[model samples]
Target: MTNYEVRANIRVVFGDGALNELPTLLERHHPKSILLVSSGDYVDDLGIGDAVRQAADSLGATLIEDRGVVPNPRLEHVRELIETAKAHNVDFLLAAGGGSAVDTAKSVAIGLAAPEGTDVWDYFTVGHAVEQVPTLKVGVINTLPGTGSEVGRSAVLTNLATKEKFGVEANNLRPVFTIVDPAFSRTVPQHFQAAAIADEIAHLIETYTADDTDVDITDRLLEGALAGALTNAAKYADDPADDNARKQLHQISLYQHYLNFDRNSDWAGHPIEHVISGDYDLLHGEGLAIVTVAWLRFIAAHKPTKLVQLVSRLYHVDAVTFSEEQVVRGFADHLEALYGRLGLPTKLSAYGIGQEGVDIVAAKVTAGGARTVGNYYALSQEDVRALLSAAL
Candidate 1:
């Protein structure tokens, strides 16, 4: 077995009613005032802002709301959030809602700590001089389970001007505390729920297949997460109010979030999805679902062994009876069917992407460097185009 290292530092409080303990956790961090970060829509729809305000009051911490975050959070939003934090003299950052909100908080935290002369984009796209600033710890009341942004150390930000999305990572980027309450997800519309599940499944599949690590524990955890997400996805699609299904999906999302720690996974699909979303403003999960089937087919041809193992472990199939191609292809078919069942478009054209759109997306993905990173087989621009073509 090869050597592997695992590290989990976040203080995780998981349960059906985890949000109730947010006040205590905030007090433990000793925050005098907190910037409550969220998307404007979720704040009103989910009443997350009100809940955080109440928690802050109970804990004797002043709350400042910054609620303009959107899907594929942008760099300008981070800068604005940093300014808000400074103006409010916030000692802590509280992120509420889904991945976009949590990711925005992480970027804000890093931007505030960054030196005045430095640019935040440099930290994301290119290595630049950065130092951890002394104030502003991070916490989350996660309303969505996808993206695992609450516990992960990296945040994905989009450059709206350039239509590029990239990641930024640092030890200090992880949240100080995260409150995951599955009950909050009960109100998520079935369409969003399906999209979230697609994104979560992509995370598990990419991580599980990317590296050649012999980490048995991580493998089991990844498989369990995929199985749970798959099962719950079907149940939740049929009945969004099923508390049991919602809980299971939340746990699986949380599990995938932590599993990414200390593990090297291919992030190819994310960049591709980012391009589609940035260019077309398509839903993040919907874009991911469209690309995933084609990406899996490419991976199956290039890394048959890994695909076979994943199928055997995740779907509980006997490898001896199922040929590698059949297993790999079957997994792709299953995912396509699932996406269809959940009312997500399975084809690129379904989202208004034709042959020319495919070419544009392929070129952008090539420029993003996803073609080389985390790929078991280095994929060329032609391969990407072919994948897009097949997706159509």
Candidate 2:
């Protein structure tokens, strides 16, 4: 048997009307002041703005709101929010959107907690230790699904200056509380929802393939997440408004992080996807839909056994033996078709990236004297180039 660690942190409040209970939970936390963060005007448009404000007023909690977060939040935005919160003397942060919003809040938490004279970006780029670092009480009321940032102990931010996107992971960076309500996700556009599905699928597959060692329990957990995501993906296509389906997808999104037995797993496509999306401003999931297939295809050639095992678990196939070509092509084609059914792009070209971006992305991934990503087969710059070229 191999030794490992697993996390069962984060108090989860999940349901259809979970949003209505947000105020109750906030009161229990008893923060004196709060910073409410969202990506756009949806907080007001969806009536959540008023609900949370009323909740804050009930407790006499000072509420300051900011709508500056963007998809794949930039480092500059995080710094600005941290400064704003400190200026307002906000004692708590309420992230009321999707992963980007939550991630921005987490970075805020990290920044607030960091020792004075330390920059938050140092944690990601320079390996600054966040243990016992200063942090604020944080909570979430998430909209949309995928990007396990809601529960995962990581916050990703992009430095537009360097054209690089990276994440900082520390135990305290995870949300103190996460509220998952399918109702909040009901209005997400179908295409974006599809992109979210592709993202969750990549999350599961990356962790599932991170190790080849036989860990029966972990395998079972990952398999369940992948299967549930696929079932719900189909359900979502049929009716994006289906609460039950949305709930399942949201649960699967959380499970992506929940099943992370090891804090670090082989994130096969993320570094590549991050570069592509950060450079060209493409949807993270849409880029993953393209990069993930290519990443897996390259991995399949090198480790067909693990590739087949991954596919068998994901597709619920009983085939224990699969040819190299069969496994790669079959799994790639299946995933591509699923993306197609969900209205997600099957290639980087669909997002306006081309052969030109391949070298730039490869260079970005290898910038700062670094190479190779993931545990399955840490990809070298050449390997990354080939992977992107294949996707192109």
Candidate 3:
């Protein structure tokens, strides 16, 4: 077995009523004041802002709410949040929504700690060195299940001016504490639930298929997460409040979040989906669902052994006996059916993307260097074009 190292430093509280633990956790962190960050919609709908305020009140911590973050969080939004946090003299940051909200909080925290003249793009994409100001402690109350952003050390942000989406990673970006309550995710719209599941599935596939090694622990971890996610996804789609199913999905999401701490592989679907999402403003999970099927097909064609191993492990099949091609095609077909069942569009055309859009997506994926990064099968620009065509 090849040697690997995994490290995660976040304190996690998971259960049916994990959010209720926030007050005590905040007190332990010893933050005098916290900037409560969430989407405007969730401020009232999910009552997340209120919950944070209540927690702060119990802890004698001042709570300042910012409710303007949007899905696929924008760099400008992070800039504004940085300004808000600085002006409020906020001693800590707390995110209380899905991946987007948590990601926004992370970016804002990083930006606030960056040097005065640093550009948001420089911090995210250009790898510019900035003085590490006092790191702000962050706590997350995850209301959504898909992005696994709560325990993750990376945050994806969209640059509106350049129409690009990129992510940044810093150990400090990991939340100091995370609260996972499946009940909160039950309120997510059915369609959004499906998209979230798709995102989780993509995360599994990317990590599972990226390299060839005897990393049994990582393999089992990835496969278990995939199986749990798929099983819970079906039940959640039928009945969102199915506590058993919600708990399983929540566990899978949390597992994927911690999986990011290990250096297993590169994120294949993310770069492609980022470009498509940046251009079309598509839902992140839905975009992932659309791109992943194509990516799987491409990888299977080029790396049959790896594909067979993944399929065998994920589905508990005999790798030697199962026709590799059939397994690969079956996986894609299954995902397509899941997308349709979840009321998500299965093809680019379903989203009104045409031939020109396909070419644009192809170029963007290549430019992002997604096809080359730790992929078991290196993909050329033509390969990316073919995948785009297949997705269309």
Candidate achieving the largest lDDT: 2
Model 1 poorest 10 in a row by lDDT? 127-136
- Whose lDDT is higher: candidate 1's or candidate 3's? 1
- Candidate 1 residue-wise lDDT, 270-347, digit = tens: 878887888887778999998888888877766768778878877787778877877898899998888888999989
Q: Candidate 2: worst 10 consecutive residues by lDDT?
A: 1-10
lDDT of 2 by residue, 179-276 (tens): 88778888777877787788899988887775545566777888888888888888888777788888888888777876666434678688888888
* lDDT score at residue 15, model 2, on the 0-100 scale: 86
Writing each residue's lDDT as its tens digit, candidate 3 over 1-392 gives 33545557788899866777877888888887789888767456756666777878877777788878778898888888788788888889988888998998888777877777976668778786422545588889887787888888788999878889988776778888999877777677787778888998889878776564557677778778888888788787677778888778778888886553343564667888898898888889989888888887777666667667767777777656757877787788887777777787868988888889878877776874454533556666677778878878
Q: Candidate 1: which pairs clash?
A: none
Off by over 4 Å in 3: 1-5, 41-47, 129-133, 260-263, 316-322, 368-374
Higher lDDT: candidate 1 or 2? Answer: 2
Clashing residue pairs for model 3? none
What is candidate 2's TM-score against the reference?
0.94
Ranking by TM-score: 2, 3, 1
Give the number of the best model, judged by TM-score: 2
Instruction: State TM-scores per candidate.
Output: 0.92, 0.94, 0.93
